[model samples]
Target chain A: MKIGIHGLTSCYGCQLSMAVVKRILDVSEKFDIKYFYMLSSAGKIEHVDVAFVEGSVSTDEDEKELRMIRENADVLVAIGSCAIHGGVQSILFSEGIGYEEAFKTVYGDKKMDYNGRIAQPLDKFVKVDYRLPGCPPEEEEIMYYLATFAIGSWPEEKDYPVCAECRRAGNPCILIEKGEPCLGPVTVAGCDARCIKYGIPCIGCRGPVSDVSWFDSLAMSFRDRGMDKEYVKKRMAIFASRYEGLNEMIDKIYGD
Target chain B: MRYLKLGSRNIDEFLGRISNYGDLYAPQKISEKFYDYRKVEDISQVEFNYNRTITPAKKYFIPPKHEMFEFDMETGEYTETMGDVKPFVLFGLHACSIVALRILDGVYLNEYPDKYYAARRKAGIIIGISCLPDEYCFCNLRRTDFVDIGFDLFLHELPDGYLIRVGSERGHEIVDENMDIFEEVSNDDIENFKKFEKKRHEMFKYEGSFDNLRYILELTENSPLWDEESEKCLGCGNCTMTCPTCRCYDVQDLPDIDGKHGKRIRFWDSCQFRSHGLVAGGHNFRETKKDRFINRYVCKNAYFYPLGTSYCVGCGNCTYFCPAGIDFLKNLIKIRDVVGEVAHGEQ
Candidate 1:
């Protein structure tokens, strides 16, 4: 099978994670690399069996490149939190801050290069067959996707919160015990609760689970723990701004 | 059953001798406020006064996650991945936890028995220990506070020693092997034990009757409290994972990047998870959080309560670890009150 790994507007961390996977040698032997600028100098976007697209559609150029990739590949996978949930850049999206206000605040009277827009998930511009959610997707999950693709199967996303694995690992409940606003209760889990195991709370870098992550309940929980509405909203929006009905869910508890 | 008294000083030496039978496992302090079951390399690591371990002793038999078998991706040829099963002496199990194992035995050891669980169950040597009930404990309500059998040996705490009850042949053998340390129980010791039992019973803070609990739970199936509490439920699935009798699991086949090799692994799955009730074609049986939240109680209180016993050992891990602070006993009491009001109105 032929595959392309493309990066549009990201830190390139997700692509880097996939590149440094321990089983890359075995994975490379199963698929032909058509376009992967990170791994090879080959930059031409051609027809491929699967295209793993990283980062969000932040610029007009990014949208065009993403559209071209979508047209060329048979399947498009939104890789990482940036491409799946708009990453941290979209944290201000729910705060009613648009690209114009953000750009003017950062770079006044400066107009150069490509047109900038509010960052949005890849699915906003084109169909996404699958999603690999994480700040930078886990190596094991990346390998799972690749292995499934190699064998003509698809990967299944976990619909449970991080607390499922976190409790099994026998980690203390930091959210309840320390009153930290850990997002483990409403975040998609596959990282084996890595952060919680190390005495750190989850930041929900993997974004929200599909239709099940009760953001309103968690926001209320945070409020009960003495966190203000804005604090809960901002913390959750860091990796899940583009999640469907997320703002409305939080609004139900915090009010409009 | 024969009773033997052993002084506190001889515990380490006795444990050292039991190492011949199997690996000694006991609760060890993981942090200031946490305890976990760990293999005892030395008797000093055992914390007999611990409240409860983070995970139960069942983990020794059925691990949280394990590879059941390895298979070829293309041909589907497989080989069992059950590593060498060995006997282990689990020391210092609380009475409630010992009863929890009995409940698990009914599930895994009857009818078409699970080979792995059966193997581990047969190899296990349980040494139960008496414990003082804390606020979270409700084992007395469940009638699991005091164990008569189900253990190889039971150690009842005394002022300066343990009143040991031999329940199995192994327990008798161990007592005979270390006869020098064993002392015959006297009339004063028996009197002290009765006084100790009375004191332990009076210390229980939580109180409720389980006589009509199953019936009340069955009648209050549509209680509005289910929805009210679900709003506070984060659906984190911590409660079920920490539960001693929750045996639901999810199996997955992970293929290696080599594509030829893969393993079918099983991991603990929670009913509280949205994926647990999810079916193919984007349909979920328990779509709402209320349904998922209520499912746990129904399974524990109504469906599994049979022959006058509850599936819930009342370890209280659910209430303790819950970030939302959903108390199981409080909910049960509320539901019972609501049902009682309705019954009174009808009469």
Candidate 2:
């Protein structure tokens, strides 16, 4: 099986994670690498069995390349927070803060031309067969997805709140124990609750899960715990600001 | 029940000997303020004074996820996934949790007994310990502080030693083995036990009276209190998952691609989740969260009363674990007041 590694607009930390971590376990025998810009001398990619695409569609160039990769591959996987939920950069876009104005604010009239309307995940432009969501996909979770997919079966993604994993890990609810405004209830699991275990409240970096009714009530819960309302709103919107209807939910709760 | 006094110095020796039989587990603080049942290899880690563990002892009997069976379809071979059971001594179960386990006996070991749960249940020798009530405790309302039955041994910690109540033959046998470590209780020890019980009863400020709890549940069936309380329900199921009496589960199948080898597992499921009552055609019996929230109170009060001695022991695990901070006893009081009004009108 020919596998291609493609990056649109990302840190390439995910691919580095694969290289650094996957080398020790030695699972390279599963498939043959066709095209990886970082790994190889830029091999031409005609077609591939599985194409792992990282990063979001933030540029015209990224959009065109994503379509070609989607058309060429049998299975397309969005492998990172950027590719799955539109990374940290996409927060600005969701807040209706134009990237052009911000870019000018930083560049100071450099007369640069970068053309893209809204930064979006690959699924917005083309279909994504599977999504491995995290700021950078955790190594063990990536291995789980790969091993299951290699066997021709869809791996079960943990779509529940992080509190499930937190409880099983025997970690006390930091939200309750320390009066911390934790996002464990609103965020997806499968990061093994790394934040909660380390005594940090969840930042919702893996994106939202089901059963949370648009996170408005969750914000109110934060306020009840004596957290600043502004901080609660900002924290809730950290990763899930771009999620559809979330803005409307925020408007309803905060009243514009 | 018999009494045995164990020296504080020999607590480890007695517990370590019990470990030879099987796993000896107790409440341990793995993180700061977060306690759960962990293997008590080091006797010093045993948190006998902890108010409650984040998870109850139920995790051992009915784990969060348990594999029931495995099947090989191609060769037509079947396998029942069963783990070996050995005698266990649960060292630090609170009175509330001891009662909670008895409540679960009604569900798992009812008309159709769960073989997996039954094996673990029979293997465990419960040793209840005294727990000082936190602000959230309402076990007094449920009268779980003083258990008439359920445990093999009950330990009340004194400054110098442990005042032990040997409730069963197993408790006696265990104590009899370590007669060198245990001494006969004196008149002062008996007086101390009485004092402890009185203080425990006084510690709990049980807000709700259970005189007509069933009638209260019936009266509040149409009350708008459910709607208000349910609004606070996060639907995260933290309450149900942490609850000792709540025994609902979801069955899952992990199948191999060849249609041959597969494992059937049972995962702990909660009613607060959206999929709990969802039918095959996608119709949900309790569509609203209010209905689901009140269903818990109804089950605790009315539905499961005949099935067991009591539906709830009021362990307060639900309140401690719920992210939304929904207090069960507090809500019960609100509903009971509405019940009073309805009953008085009828009179």
Candidate 3:
């Protein structure tokens, strides 16, 4: 099997995490890593078994590249939280700032003429067979899905809340022990409560679970803890502004 | 079920007993209201009842600064390094925190199968203990409690001694190795355990349910709340840094003095920061604080949900740790109420 990895406008953590897997194990033996921008020279698109795409589609170049990859690859997997749910880049779409204004602000005084467009996850433009969601895709998870895909068996999707795993891991409940607000309950299960296990609370980097209502419960969980309603709405809006349902709920509950 | 009668003073004896197995890591008081897990020679220094540590135990499985590979610029060659540490025992894990580890395992072990995380994970054994609820605690609200995933053994403190619950085959091995120190549980002891659980539950309550969070989040979009809430955010990133589940990170290639040999390092990044979404040619996606601020919650509550699981755990850490004192709970209510008003044309 051959796999190609690409990055859009992301932090490159997903690519780094994949590299970490190679160090830990000889994944190269299983699949031929045909192309990676950071590791190898950009190679011509070939008929590959799987193409792992990272980051969000923020530019015309990214959109064009994503479309080309989708056309060639048999399976397209959106790796990293950004690629799956726009990571942090989707924040632009929520604000009224068009892509053009955003570009001018960043590249001030540069004679770069370009049109503005809202950033979106790869799925918005092309079909994604699978999604490995995380700010930086967990190295182990990437391998598991790949191996599973390689074996011709689709990996079962996880639906448990982060709190479920947190409980099963036998770590102290951050909410009960420290009165700290966490996103474990509504957030998806994957990150192994690493933050909570390390004495920090969950910040929802993995994204929400299957149920959208879980986010409402998370916000309510905060309110029950005596947190200010407006504060919760603002904090949640930062990562999921494109989720119109969640946005409307936040506004209603917070009286915005 | 088994019972052990180790005195608090003889905790060092317990550590000594376990040392024969492998390395021992326990919570040590770093400062007032702060504790860190470190290699310990003496068990007396282990603080079993800290509210919560500044860092989550996830560091052991996934170190904050791990070297995935080393590159030599002179040769343009890369050498991958695997972290092969000895098997170590982590002592004094809280229930919520352990749940956090399980969440990570689900992500790392399932679809992608992270070799680095899996390799490091195999080198450690977890020992958990019950935690005392504090003012900021809300684990009950999230439906979290003492659990036994990936842990060999769990310790529940009693007035007279400690009750040990064997959770795995490894736990049974540990117990059998130290058979002299443990005894079988009796009917009376089981009754006492139930009483203890009851007392603990009385002190803890489910703060709220996430059932309505999605609806609230959906309505809040384009609501005035985004502007109102963004006004107070300083974008300092304290919330993300202190978050247990916030795994967003930035990878940078660090060059050596000669710029020939350098290592790539991953550091925690936050959505709250303005530059978090910036790309090459200087295109910033999330330019406004309002957009950035709203995206954080959406990622946790809405966007991540359809993909798989809800990223947020409702631990209340963001509320306690926010420097600007942005309360997540209040925001939920405000968003819900406002979205309702707007929908009803009452605005």
Number of the top-ranking candidate, with DockQ as the measure: 1
Candidate number of the best lDDT: 1
Please state the CAPRI-style docking class of candidate 3.
incorrect
True contacts kept of 2: 0.24
Candidate 1 lDDT for residue B225 = 87
Cα shift from native, residue B47, model 1 (Å)? 1.3
Which pairs clash in model 1? none
* Docking level for model 2: acceptable
Report the C-alpha lDDT of model 2 over A128-228, residue by residue, as the tens digit.
99887777778767766665555567666654577777775667788888888788887777787899888998888888764444376576677677776
The model with the greatest TM-score is: 1
Candidate 1 accuracy as TM-score: 0.95
How far does residue B32 in candidate 3 sit from its true spot (Å)?
A: 2.3
**A84-160, model 3: which lDDT tens digit per residue?**
77766677666556876787788876764444366687888999998787778676577667656655555444444
Model 1, runs deviating above 4 Å: A251-256, B206-208, B303-307, B342-347
Q: Write the per-residue lDDT of candidate 2 for residues B1-347, one digit (tens) a residue.
A: 68789878888887887787678898888766778899976888888778777877888888887789897757767788686788888878888888888778877888468999999999998888887788888877776677757888888876667898888888888888778988888888878777877777778876544646767786667888777777766666677777777788878656643334677778777776566777888798877777788778877765355334457777778887778877887787777667675666543
Candidate 1 structure quality by residue, lDDT tens digits, A18-102: 8898877887899898888888885799999999999988999999999999999999999988898888887878778988899
DockQ of each: 0.71, 0.27, 0.02
The regions of model 3 sitting more than 4 angstroms off are A1-256, B1-10, B205-208, B302-309, B333-347
